[model samples]
Target: MTIPLVRVHGVDDVRLDNIDKPRTAPGDVLIEVLLCGICGSDLGYIGMGGLGMTHPMPLGHELVGSVAEVGERVSHLQIGDRVVVNPMAGGNSIGNGGTEGAFSPYLLVRNVAADERAVIKIPDGLSVDQAAMVEPLSVALHGCRQGNAKAGDKVVIFGAGPIGLCVALCLNYLGVERLVIVDQSSHRLAAAESIGAVPFKAGSNNLGEFLIQQHGQSELMGMPVPSSDIYIEATGAKPVFEQIMNTAKTGARVVVLGLHKQSVPLDLANVLLRELNIVGSMAYSDEFPAVIEMLTGGKIDLQPIISHRFPLSQFSEAIAQASEPDEAIKVLIDCQC
Candidate 1:
């Protein structure tokens, strides 16, 4: 049968064309995608070409799908079972700096003998769109887990993008009392506020001073205390790293969740003398189930985030729509159409 899934034919070029539906490999399952969320990595690779891509590539990882077929060795799943595919698995390869996890239309989790380990079951009642959010939410959850949030702790999340907002929401779930989100985009900052976090514009002259005066009260060592007990950096901006350091109170913990190409300066002294703990969070480990439960329990604002949708045939248009200001928080492609 002809399968309809979007493919990145070239840099900045996505085309929707009829391709053969997949069949199960030795340890594989063919999934009909239900929903998919485009990620910044996808955009970056598509716009830059082969920079973070493997040849014979597909570019979506945040997704919900159902088993169309299962291989003889795949006993845990069967046809028609809905699932969220976690293509980000562990293996060493050239693309993506020797990582085996992936984003694709139909993913194959090759094992030791070209085996597979990329499928995770999804719960009922959670929409496909929400399932598509699992990866990003998992990223947020992973970072918050590293922060070790405690009740009454404060968290400052930089970048009001989906990742940032997800971090804030996850922090709320983790019992943080004071959640501060920093973003320069009025649209995204408004999103952070809509979800009950106090939003501040980054890059403002008075940004640090404003936060210090309002929330920097607890004195860890007479260092004007701290505002965010945990600071989550999600903007990936080089300068925001400096801001995260300057704004953090004594003995604060910082988690870096953003991705950028250039290296930024660091303050090892502050981290040393003040007992600041700086941690870097990569993707996720095994947090999809909890994220799905969070979605089912109404802990996240996902529907409003999915501001745009398009038929698979209009893939180019969908990408264009996602690029505009006040644009899509999540954009989906209806592959069956």
Candidate 2:
């Protein structure tokens, strides 16, 4: 049977074309894609047009699939095995295993060794859509690891988007004493509160004064809020990034997990004055294997993140959902259709 694929042929358009099903190349594996989660980078590529990202490329990096065929040289993966693609597979950074980008109905594993390389198998009870989120979830995990959140440290996240929420979720698992999530969106802030974090709605005139007067205490968490020992900036907006820089407490570790516009102004005196240590987290390392384990082990519940799904034919519709404010988080495309 000829497998149909939805390919991005241009800057802002996609085409549904019938392409031949991939064959089992010497060292490659053919996968039947189950679900591909829409990521922030995907929209950046589309919305930025030519300047936003590279052209004539598949945009998705968060993906999951099942093995349809495996090459003779491929020893580990066989036909009918469920799997998920790791985006860092080809990078020098960690967690860069598996295929290039898995956005099509079928994808090809590249020139890496199969036995020691390629995607990880999904255990029973983990749905394909949940498996698809391993990429972003790994990002959150890396942020948590970088922040070094201990059992009783105060952690504050700047954004309540998928990445921020994921970081909050993982930090809770790490036994952090208090999780303070800062966001401007009422909806996103509410969602953060639902998952054990004391949600702070920023963008208010009296936000700083209110927090100061109350002494960072939250009735929801039933305790005096700890000073932010570590801060994770998940939203890269210029003003928001500035707010994060100015507001971080002295002698704290700040991890920049969000992607910003081009660049922004920074107060050098603050860093020098406070002895703040700042670091930039590019992408995932070899964290997908652990993410797969976390998913299968049920350490984190990803169900809340995946708020919408669409068939492959509605690629445009799926991408559009990402910008809608009322839509919860992480809309996915079911490639099986």
Candidate 3:
């Protein structure tokens, strides 16, 4: 038997091809992918061919699936059980670094019994779409954890994209006193507003000035400008990074969640003077269960952020839609459809 899968051959060159169905080895698990989300990093890989990819690469990481076959040694999961896959287990993250991903009819979870972090069973009441979102929400949760956002803290997120919106939602759920989201897209800002974040148009006004006018100046001693307790740079835009670095409050925790395509010069003096705690967050580890719990408990809603869905065969169109910041928030690929 063969399976249909999507792979990137070159820049802007993604194609669907058929390959042999993976044979179930002892201790392996076969998953029938249900849903997968197209992330910004996937777009980057599609557009640039490889940030470091030396060969054709599979694309997609945010995914949920059901077990189709379980190896003899795989005792934790049985056929027909729904699960959220952890792509990063054993340094073999799906859709990244040459690992084949969930953008296919099936996926083989190799050596599942060996890695305790292999997969998490989705709790009841969470739809497959919601379960598919666990990966990105885990990313947002990790970023929030890095920032150390606490109750009554004022937070500013510099991007209203999916990750940014997720960050806003996580911060709000953490009992943030005030949450502001900055983005140039009205559609995205509106989405952010719907989630209880105060949205600010990035180009219409200076971010610092707008925050001061809306939230009033910061009262922290020795701080020269109005600022938020936590500043999250989620846009990966160099200018946005520079802007936040220059205007963030003294002793603020700056969380970097977005993947920067290129290195941008940082104002070391400002960083040193303000004593900003710049934290870099990578893909999640140990945060998936918390995100799932939050979803199950109604602490956060991811449905609204999923603005578009496309069948796996329409991945090109899905990628195009995901590339448009004004038109889509989180674009999903319905593998089971």
lDDT leader:
3
TM-score of 3: 0.96
What overall lDDT goes with each candidate model?
A: 0.70, 0.70, 0.84
lDDT of 3 at 27: 78
Per-residue lDDT tens digits for candidate 2, residues 1-337, read 6765554555676555666666666776777788888777667655544232343444556788888877777777778988876655633111122223455678766532444445677887888767888888889989888877688877778888888988887887778847788887787877888888887877666544444443353321243322467889888877767765665556668888999877887778878865678887777667777777777776777766678898888877887887774565788888777
Candidate 3 residue lDDT tens string, 190-252: 999988999999889676778887556864356557767888999888888888877877788
Model 3: lDDT of residue 62: 88
Itemize residue pairs with steric clashes in candidate 2.
Answer: 88-96, 89-96, 89-97, 94-285, 94-286, 95-285, 95-286
- The list of candidate 3 runs beyond 4 A from truth reads 51-54, 219-223
Candidate 2 residue spans exceeding 4 A from truth: 50-55, 91-101, 112-117, 209-226
Candidate 1 lDDT at 119 equals: 74
Error of 1 at 289 (Å): 1.7
Worst 10 residues of 1 by lDDT: 92-101
Can you rank all candidates by TM-score, best first? Answer: 3, 1, 2
TM-score of each: 0.88, 0.86, 0.96
Q: Residue pairs in steric clash, candidate 3?
A: none
